[model samples]
Target: MTQGLDIEQMLAQHIARLKASLQQASGEGSGPEEGSDAWLLLNAFVENDPQNWHTLLANFEQSGHWLAEQGGKLDVRIVALQRYIDALVAELKQILSEQPLLLVETVERLHLLQSESIQALTRGYQSVTDQCLRDKDMFSQQLEHRLLALQRINGVSNSAMDLDQTLEITAQAIAEELQVDLCSIFFYDDMQRVLTLRATNGPRPLGGMHFTQRIGEGYSGWVAEKGQSLLVHDVMASPNFASEVQAYSSDYHGLMSLPIIFFGDAERLIGVISVLSQEPRDFTREEISFVEIVAGIIAINVENGRLYEQTDEQLRRKVHELATIHRVSSVIASTLNLDEVLQMITTQAVHLSGAERSCIFELDPDRRRLHVLAHYGLNANLVGQLYINVGQCCAGRTVQTGRPSMAVDCFHTDEHCFIRSDPFISSEIHSVLCVPLKVKDKILGCLCVYSSHRHLLSAEQMQLVNLFANESAIAIENARLYEETRRGLELKSVLLRELHHRVKNNLANVAGILSLQRRRSKSSDVRHILAESVNRVQGLAATHDLLAHEDVSEARVDEVARKIVGVASTNLVPPEKHITFKVEPCGIVIPSRAVTILALIINEMVSNAIKHGLAGQSVGRVIVRGREEDGWVYVQVSDNGTGPAFNLQFGENSESSSEGLGLSLIKNLAGDLEGQFSLRREHDLTSQNGTNTTGDGPAEYTVAEVRFPLVRRSRTRE
Candidate 1:
């Protein structure tokens, strides 16, 4: 019995030390206090038997009631003590029944042990209350730190312009705020299905390191692929931590990878933010929540920066395009030559479009082929040999459809492939921009720009090229018209010079024939008739002389009429008659054929008026007037002198009452013109006030008028 009692004492002491050690580890208290209910219950159980069990159990119940009253509720430490007391009572009852002698000797010590058990219970409850207060304070501090880090992250995200810089700043902030060893940001490349390490701040001393991982292959990639957050306490033990991450950095023991999901219905996963710790750590709920919030902020800022870059680039391109258009417009406006204009267009296209070479293809309508008219930055031989059938290649297709076409990365793409198989050139061209040169609905040709490097032209660049193509078409058409006009003018000038030469030679022959006739005649009347005929021929020759000096395609009727009237007046009008010859200004121009006929008609009329009407007068006035009105040309020759009162002749077959050669010639010439001839008496010329009369007492005057349809050989002249 004595040995058994000693064993129980040793066991009770070991149990008390174990409880105290557990309480200290749990941050409760070092041990139960003296005189507490927990200390009393422990001592009574260690020393008492079944006779004292009932009393000890009663004392334990009373101590639990007192702790509940003092501590407000049943704490974990009090509950554990109550369970221990119930087990102690059951053991003590078993000992009394099995070993009656052992309980008989320990029963007298129960009163002393009860006080120590109650003291232990009270101390355990107090330790539990203090631990609860410490935990609450720690949680509050963690929450406050998380909120401050979130504010700093938001500030960095909102003010950053550059995406890479923003990412670096975000990574550094996260690492410093969370007290992490490493913070890495991985951007997901959707096309490649990979995550590229974009930014990182860590102790590994990575310098100029580029790392990428396929989705579902590594720690960061798995988060992006799954679109979930993963908290790995022990990277080596976690099955999700891939071997690649193990190989990348063996220094990290803890990892938290969260997917950066964009805010949308699809919730697109853009990337992953990984926070790593050098020592093993179980991340708190607050830390994980903070990381997720920062990831959302980083995703939004990245997308915004990308959109800003795109918009800014578009604006810059627009400015450049406008300037290019202005320059091309200046070039188009300054020139009328076709070749020079095409050359300028090709050069500007290559420079402005960032193309390696450019060519302007002109369509041959008859051949139905596109021929290179001008080119820049290409082999001369190749350009000379380059031609494509309509609807065959890039340029040809643009012409056939009258729309723009582009081939990006032509070497790899089969659709709308560029012409790289040509034998004349071995240059590897990768992209092409072909725009049709169209005016109205007519496609003149196509302008093609090529690049040796593979790249796609933006919509703005494409639109600018199309606009330039339209301008080029207009300029080309204008040049073509100018060339045609110049050629026509040159041909017309040659014909007019030839006609004048022939007319001069023919008039000289006629004058020679009249001179011969005049010299052979014996009678004075015959000689006078031959001389008058020679004067008519000389009048016609003088009209041709005026036309030959003026480099014009046709002669003016008024100018011819003046020359003819001057010749007639000088030869036929007597100086003693004081005849003043006047010719009114006219704005009528006729072909060379019409001028000869008009000269002969005017010559006969003026000679007849001078010789017949002013034959017996000492003073006379002969006036010739030519005018065109209402599609008819009228010429009037009048003299204020006595003349024959001849009737008007209306037809070619009508005969004259007088047998004079001048009247017969005048009638025949009028018939040749398909015109009407009339003779009438004219009153003396008078001013508006009737003060400037040519002669007194209504001087007898004869007026000869010829009228003919005004014919236009070409464009009408004013």
Candidate 2:
């Protein structure tokens, strides 16, 4: 109560101060008012208290209740309470008026407190909003970076050329960019229902792509089968992701698989892109969308590469076909010898048709056996030994029936010929095709091709084989005709040689009769011409003897020269002091006409050397040397004895001995040989004394030399 009295005293002092001030200013007694702006402001402050606000608002709602409650307060007891309250109000106004700056300061302080709280709340909200914006910007930047990497990959146009390399590149890029522990691409083979690891990056296993995940069984495979993206936040926890060997030690987690689908053809899922991480990372909607775009690009490129390869293979096959046709045509156009042509055809057939071996078997006239007329792949022993009876091997059957025969697999067929039995049949021959080699209506032979595998040749290849065989049959027929023509020519030549022999013998008989007549009636001129004619006939006979004795279809130049020299030497030189003969070692061969002509030329030269050069001398030496040089044959006949003047003209008009006839014969023979003829003085011309002496003045010993070109003959006639 005494404390209450101190409150009363304080209020009285405030009221007294205000009353004294107001009386000095306006001199009016204005008490505590029923209505005032200060009172309303004070009431508003009291109403703002959350705990008492409702009760104060209720109190303010009823003015009559407040007045009735204060009506009994006019009593001294109530007057004192009211006076205390009035004094409290007057003191509150006095305090407010006396310290006007204090009132303003209190209002400003309260406003400052409210403003500080609002400012603190705003700062906190701004901080939270800023953090959210930064997170959004970071996400946007990460998306942009991912798109840039995808763009970089798309810029590589050459990747389309090779799919394996492209997949590998994409896998590696994603692994590096995403900081993934594992990245791989699996290509789905629809036919096999298996996913093959096409490309991989980061920590490749021992054998790359060794493990295969079945479609609808594992995470990647199921995603590919369903043609959708898949996210395995924890691989260990995923039901689809089973591990044979646990790669994680309970800490490793998370995996992502994206299906690579062809855009236009959505049902055809090409493959899947898989990414693995050690830590769990939530893949947002945007990230999955980006991966899908990458998958579409990959799928389209793989499809494109496959199409190109298929087209390329088809083109290659067509090129091979054209080459085979051209090769077969060339073989048909070239040769006329049947065996030679058939061998050529077999070789070309094997080469062009890509067969390992081939053969041409002809039907022997007996028709009992198929003869291997020509074989390209046969060894030396097998060439003639390889034969089969009619209705035996493929070739034999083709010949017997006059129809084509083919054994797509020789190994599968037990019907093999006895004659055709060989180690090669088991080791090398596994397939065979044979066609009849016929001329008009006759089956001449069978053309056969062999390989080391069953059905290795295709339908197109078989057609080509048939075409080539048909063309080759015509060539074979032409070769047979050529052979017949050659045999006829050879027979005619033999008959002509026999005729020559008989004619020479008849001429010899006539010469013998003429010699008897020369011994009986004897006009010297007649005898001389007759003897000369006999000598010419004898020369012809000697040529015929040589041609027959050599037993060759060709002429021998050496033999002709030696025989003519022997004949001429006997007649020209006496037995007591015969001219020493020096003949060069010879083995020169020439044509029949050239041989006869060369023999005559040698006869004349040797006769001249013995008769004139060795005359009036005993033990005289004559040398006959023949040599070939620079495509020509040179014959030199020389002697140490005296001879007729070489410089003198040697025709019927000249004063030469019977030697003129020999010289004339030599000139004619030389002309026949297509040779150059010349007569010159022998070098080192002397008597047996070895002194430099010209026994016959300017023309000591006559020497004849002839030069003729060597004509090369075809050794074997076609």
**Each model's backbone clash number:** 19, 2
Q: What TM-score, over all chains together, does every model reach?
A: 0.42, 0.39
Off by over 4 Å in 2: 1-165, 172-182, 186-230, 236-252, 258-272, 277-341, 351-356, 364-369, 376-392, 400-403, 408-420, 438-444, 481-718
Q: Write candidate 1's Cα lDDT for 213-274 as tens digits.
A: 78888787788878888888878677667464565544787888899989866777789899
- lDDT per model vs. reference: 0.69, 0.60
**Best prediction by TM-score:** 1
**Residue 401 local lDDT, model 1:** 84
Steric clash count of candidate 2 = 2
The RMSD of every model to the true structure, in order and in angstroms, is: 34.3, 34.8
Report how far off residue 689 is in candidate 2 (Å). 74
lDDT of 1 at 173: 84
Error of 2 at 681 (Å): 67
Q: What's the lDDT for candidate 2?
A: 0.60
Off by over 4 Å in 1: 1-141, 160-172, 175-202, 205-228, 236-252, 259-272, 277-279, 335-338, 350-357, 362-372, 377-422, 425-436, 440-444, 449-462, 478-718
Deviation from truth (RMSD, Å), model 1: 34.3
